[model samples]
Target: MPKLKIAASLLAGEFINLERDVKEIEKAGIDLIHLDVMDGHYVPEITFGRQIISTVMKLTKLPIDIHLAVTNIDHTINGFMQLHPRCIFIHPETSYMPIRLLENIAQAEVLPGIAVNPTYPIDSAKNLLEYYGGVCDVLFMSVEPGYGGQPIMHKRLQIAKNLRPFVRGSMWIDGGINPNWAIEAKKNGVDGVVSGTYVFNDVQPMKLNVDSLRGESLSWRTP
Candidate 1:
């Protein structure tokens, strides 16, 4: 089994001091920075845009994964593509042709991933797996999107386990992931874990929580 990667979600980061939060996360040895972009339509909230993403891109060299929690993905994909994020994830519920969209993202030379909400059945994304030959670089399973500090729905881990054989690349578990849950996610076949609140809740300037989570994730190997 591959090593589990640690991704820090921006939703739990200090929004008031966005740039500073990202810089601190990078310094914490995070593998990737996860950005949740919600457009009021798909989810109840609208958060950030290309301007914010561009600023974030300028702040850190760490790979960025943008999760599009919106209905109007097409309206913003190009703009975000220009920023050259390491990976872009669009909801299977929002995209008209998720597989084709993933293909387009791949054609742009960026990693393409599909985001599945906790309630959405993994079988619903079967076409994506079939058409793409299960080649998505990342599979983001959201326990709860557009929010922070929710409990990790164990069923989502089952979804990740179900996709293990079909997924050719990496599988990322998002929403409410902390050091306590990282080991279970890895044991359940997750390739990466995304944490937001667990990292920013630390009062220590060095981001002890973030560093500890990353350290804990690395300690769990595939047996």
Candidate 2:
């Protein structure tokens, strides 16, 4: 397998010093920047909106990846599209017309993907994978409601195996991604890991924290 790419989520960074945090991530050679747009109704937390994401885009040279965890997918999506994000992942559960929304994202020239919740069935998404997934740059599997150092729920690794056959692009796991979990992810065919707390919630320099995630290896045996 190729090296694991790390998409660091800036939400977990110190928002008061946002510019400095962005600069730190850029210097760390982080491969991608992951942003979450959440409405209180959808995921219980209201994260920032479009303008903030646009600001984040301005602060970095890295590619921006977005997860749409909002209820108003139709009204809010266009604002993000205008920013030309690297990839936009819409939870298939949120849209009544998910296929159409995914198509709209493609029309705007952004890579479109489905973000499967940990409990959502892959069987239900096979067709979605067959269609939009083929052209997508990555399949973003959220395997964490997990923290940075806890043992990965082995079941989560199973999801990667289930997704391995059809995903043409890379498979990325979001949440609770540490090096040990990353080794197991590679064994299961996962190509990238997304982390917010792991990258930002530390006294370690951002370079040490961010670099720790991307260049993971399985050379040593992992049980």
Candidate 3:
């Protein structure tokens, strides 16, 4: 089994002190920084654009896993690739030509991935996952795409288990990914997790939460 990694979502970080939060997460050994690039037309929310992604690039050297939840696939793809994200994920439902876009991303030497919503049929994306030397990966959504802080759709976990054998690349789960859910995802062949509120929550220190999500023993720091 591949190692399970924790990707801390920047969407749930402190906007006022974004750089600081990113640095702290880097110190805590986060595997990647999950950036949600949302366009208001596709998803109800508007989030990071090229500008914010550029600034984040300066903040940390960690690999960036950009999730593009936008309608204009060509335009959005053209814009974000300039920043050279480690992995670029697009929602197939929003794209008119998802396979082409995935191929384009691979041709550019950037990792390509598809984001499958809760209702998208798993088999619908099977061919794309096998395309272009199997560079295409997957981001399985456990909740709706537009917003955060939603509960994990437990049913989706089974999909990951069922598709694990067919996926040549990584499989990740997003939304409501706490320590317990992270464990469950791993059991279901998920290679990584995108955690927002749970990772950045204040009740427990971020490092402790990150470690716990990896199934390490919890260590406390008394105030």
Best by lDDT: 3
lDDT of 2 by residue, 53-93 (tens): 88888888789998887887877799888899999988887
Top candidate (TM-score) = 3
Off by over 4 Å in 2: 137-152, 215-223
> What digit string (tens of lDDT, one per residue) describes model 1 on residues 1-223?
5556878888876677998888787787778888988888787877878888888888888999888887767666877777778888888777677777888888888888887777777776655776788468655565668778887776777677777776777888887776667777788788888877776675544346655565543432111
Residue ranges of candidate 3 with Cα displaced over 4 Å: 131-133, 218-223
Q: Could you tell me the lDDT of residue 161 within candidate 1?
A: 77
| Candidate 3 local distance difference test against the native | 0.84
TM-score of 3: 0.94
How much is 128 displaced in model 3, in angstroms? 2.7
Question: How do these models rank on TM-score, best leading?
Answer: 3, 1, 2
- Compared with the true structure, the alpha-carbon lDDT of candidate 1 equals 0.75
Full candidate order by lDDT, most accurate first: 3, 1, 2
Look at candidate 2 and tell me the lDDT of residue 9. 81
The whole-model lDDT of each prediction reads 0.75, 0.74, 0.84
